[model samples]
Target: GRGQAPATGQAPPPEGNLRARLTSFVGREEDIRVIGDDLARARLVTLLGAGGAGKTRLSQEAAEAHARVGGGWPDGVWFVGLAPVDDAEDVAQAALAAVGARDTKLRGAAAEELRVLAELTSDSDPLHRLVEHCGRRRMLIVLDNCEHLVDAAARLAEELLARCPGVQVLATSREPLGVPGELLRPVEPLPPEPALQLFADRGAAARPGFRVEDDLPAATEICRRLDGLPLAIELAAARLRLLSPRQIADRLDDRFRLLTSGSRTVLPRQQTLRAVVDWSWDLLDEGERTVLRRLSVFAGGCALAAAEAVCADGRLDALDVDALLGSLVDKSLVVAAPGDLGADGMRYRLLETVAEYAAERLAEAGDDKEATERRHLTYYRELARTTEPRLRGRGQRAADRLLSTEHENLHTALRRALAAGEVGELLCLVHALSWYWQLHDLRAESRHWSGAVAALGPDPFA
Candidate 1:
């Protein structure tokens, strides 16, 4: 499950400090369509995506749309915001409060006090009250920011879905709850056209008469560079008051530094790209964090075997690599996609902003940067040498495709090998990849590596 929904949109209205946003909702037509269909069919639908991917906003849109269509959720849509609540035990109480289901007797009392009074005098648990209040009441429940309290939210959702047949849950989280009867919808960045439209809309609002047509190319470039992430694009557009769209596009090379401004009223974790990423980073255990940092060493992405060879060691040994990698993907810290790596394998990657954050973490780790780089260099070197043979004969095209997908990683590895003066590794990599370099017409890189090999003189053994 994604988690609980936030208090937004007209159906739920603003109550109990739940204020709607001033900015207009942007693209996500496909997301809204899929989630609406899921809600119609599945009882539990989770909107899963990265922290700033606009899961909550999409959920709000879905709920409002459902309300407008008279989908027969008689009790209406209830949104429970769990971002501010840290303790697992508080999750149920937060939901109850969101739905206005807390005991009426202690209405004006402090929340902690209300909890104590209810626990001491009443035999009913918050879950029981929620179940009783919502019994036979057809309604949709939205859980927002469930990543931190996933266990508690999952348990609550499981019970609610089981006991209340009339209740449906739509949650937004960085990952799913992995519960039975759950539908996971992966939300992605907007496409180029919608991204440009969203930027235009917000950019005009940010600076009166900011004509998107005048800077259409630069604005498109901005969206492309930001990978069409809603929050990132919004933050960049917010800068139009001070900087030109071209400046925004150019400065994106250092996104963390450039995309720093965010509305102070929002959560600090949501104020900037780095802050959103940090919220996810702070959730990882030591092994996951270590693997994430190490995997950032790869430029494009890595296959499972490549990841195991480069990232697994010490506490995160080869045996644990698969599970750890799976966990990262589940948590949305890493993305999994089908690739040309191999028939049986999938490629995994960090988004550019995420990879940048991991690189910062690696720089700060200071424990085994050298060792990790050496392993990465060694792994890719051996990989090239072993695969070079396959690049001949009938299998040539397949091998070429595989190497092309890994070209960025290969370049990064070779650069490190050269810098560290690993003569054996450098020579072997150059010899193995020369055909690929030539096949792709990378004349300059081919010449440079071949020249370096010749400068190293003949192999002593031959």
Candidate 2:
């Protein structure tokens, strides 16, 4: 049942085994249409997103939709699951088995087909034989879970796209295969209405009499707190069998503990909130993990210089921060966006769930949480000190905008300083941020910060 070649004169299977789902597919009609359009043009299309963002489920739905639409991928849509297979060398073999597995059913030669399928290509190269087999068929091959063996998957996709004129590939991965002409579609979290609908749908399924309107606000807040991730919503909905929507929303700080009700039929990683992220966390190298762990200290996301100052050390140089951050982004562990500054505007952040996991990792690793926070404190203190002067000059608006961006970080640093009784640093931060705080009209917050500073017994610097 490993990599095997088709028997000569063995007829091709008329169609594929993209399994029909039992649950109602919700809130992704537009996404389905977009994927249809992308598949219409690109030979290789990868649906990229973090684990449990429902890429595989979405891909299956898209394939089924395409099959119904017809005229494209005429031979059929074949699903080759790469999740259970770990070795890069075995990907071709798994694919060979999947495409041929369907055919064995059609011929009604189950016993004979198994024998023939097992006999061929056990000695020869399975990949070369697979490409040859697919050479003539017009089909869409769904390559699911390629992130674990990305390079090999890319090679297989490249080979098929180059040699098989009629075959198209629709892949689902946490990252791209980097193959030429590979169309990438990033799967984002569901929006509010859709997220609520999904939560309510799954929640009612969990408890027959459950209604989101029973606790509308709490239901909406639950979706918001979970970042609208479909898997998280489903897991939370499963809690309805025991807890109320309000109770679930309140316990999200312990989401790893609370949201464990995933489907038994799915992969183990998909069976829990922590397990979903743990799968991604295991994929990172040491340097990437270290950076990610340190990054958890940040409240609002940081810019390049902030990350370098807070995250880098002797093991990982300041220069490695950008590359590692970019790598994390590529792997879907981090989210990056353009900020207020031009050219140097990319701000990097983790999802709330991811940041929580990284924090847990940081604690478990015992990697100087206070030191990281202190560096975070020092970085923003200097930023505020530098920007304070610029705020009165021609660069006033730009400086204010930058300072405004770090509002949460600045407040966090201020609170940490006050807690540490670092009165000297506390005073400097208060002074530095005082102007920007006033400009932003945070008088109540300003008064509270001033009062905290005044209550610090005596001014050592003075």
Whole-model Cα lDDT of every candidate shown, in order: 0.82, 0.87
How far is 269's C-alpha from truth in model 1 (Å)? 1.0
Q: For candidate 1, which ten residues in a row score worst on lDDT? A: 1-10
Q: Candidate 1's residue-wise lDDT over 297-415, tens digit each?
A: 98888888889988987667786888889999999889999886457569999988788889888888896677788888988888898889888778898888888888898999888
Candidate 1's displacement at residue 150, Å, is 0.4
What residue runs in model 2 are displaced by over 4 Å at the alpha carbon? 1-14, 119-123, 459-462
Per-residue lDDT for 152 in model 2? 92
Tell me how many residue pairs clash in candidate 2. 0
Estimate, for each residue in 415-447, the C-alpha lDDT of model 2 and write its tens digit: 999999998888899999888888889899889
- Clashing residue pairs in candidate 2 (N, C-alpha, C atoms within 3 angstroms): none
